[model samples]
Target: MARVVVDVMLKPEILDPQGQAVQRALPRLGFDGIAIAEVRQGKRFELEVDGPVDDAALTRIQELADTFLANTVIEDFTVKVEPS
Candidate 1:
């Protein structure tokens, strides 16, 4: 079996309120020295395939991501086959 990873993130132009909240709380949580400039939170989806991943499978996964997993208007996603 093989694993595929999907990383979904907000587009650069969009505002990430959840990420901003986390960033604001970092200092209060005793993480002040990190010098973090910004934080954009996102989602990850892992798919386990029954066999080797091929071009067709990748295409299908991409379609699935575009159709059901992410908001096309405000988010972008990347799909990669994980090293087994």
Candidate 2:
């Protein structure tokens, strides 16, 4: 089996309210030393496939990410195949 990881995140120009909220609350939570200039929340998905990883599967995964996992208009996604 092969494990595929898909990471979906907002585009740089997009606003991430949830991440921003977390960043704002960090200071109050005694994480003032964390000098994070910005924050962006994202989603990660792990998929298990029953075969050797290949370029075709990776291409399909990218298509799936573009069509279903992420909103291409506002977000970007990356697909990675993990060593079995």
Candidate 3:
């Protein structure tokens, strides 16, 4: 088994109203000297699979990303496959 690390963050040009709300509230909540804040959404899923590094597994991983791991409409991600 191996650990798969996936990370996704909102595009910089996108509006993040939730993050903005948090930023606005910070000073009022006694958080001093605040500059800025940005929000992003992501998740990490750990699953067990048996295989050596091969063309087949890499293709499967890519398919997983395309089918389920990513929201193509709003986000992008990179997956790192590591040995256990």
The best candidate in terms of lDDT: 1
Residues 1-84 of candidate 2: C-alpha lDDT, one tens digit per residue: 999999999999999999999899998999998699988899999999998778988899899999999999999999999887
What is the TM-score of candidate 3? Answer: 0.63
Between the candidate structures 1 and 3, which one is better when assessed by TM-score?
1
lDDT of 3 by residue, 1-84 (tens): 666666555555667676678777778998867565554445565545575746787678777876787776776767677667
Error of 2 at 40 (Å): 0.7
lDDT of 2 at 80: 92
Model 1 Cα RMSD, Å?
0.6
Candidate 3 overall lDDT versus native: 0.67
The parts of candidate 2 lying over 4 Å away from their true place are none
lDDT of 1 by residue, 1-84 (tens): 999999999999999999999999999999999899999999999999997799999999999999999999999999999999
- The parts of candidate 1 lying over 4 Å away from their true place are none
Model 1 scores a TM of 0.97
Clashing pairs in 1: none
Name the lDDT value of residue 75 in candidate 3. 64
Between candidates 1 and 2, the one scoring higher on TM-score is: 1
What lDDT, from 0 to 1, does candidate 2 have? 0.93
The backbone clash count of each candidate, in order, is 0, 0, 0
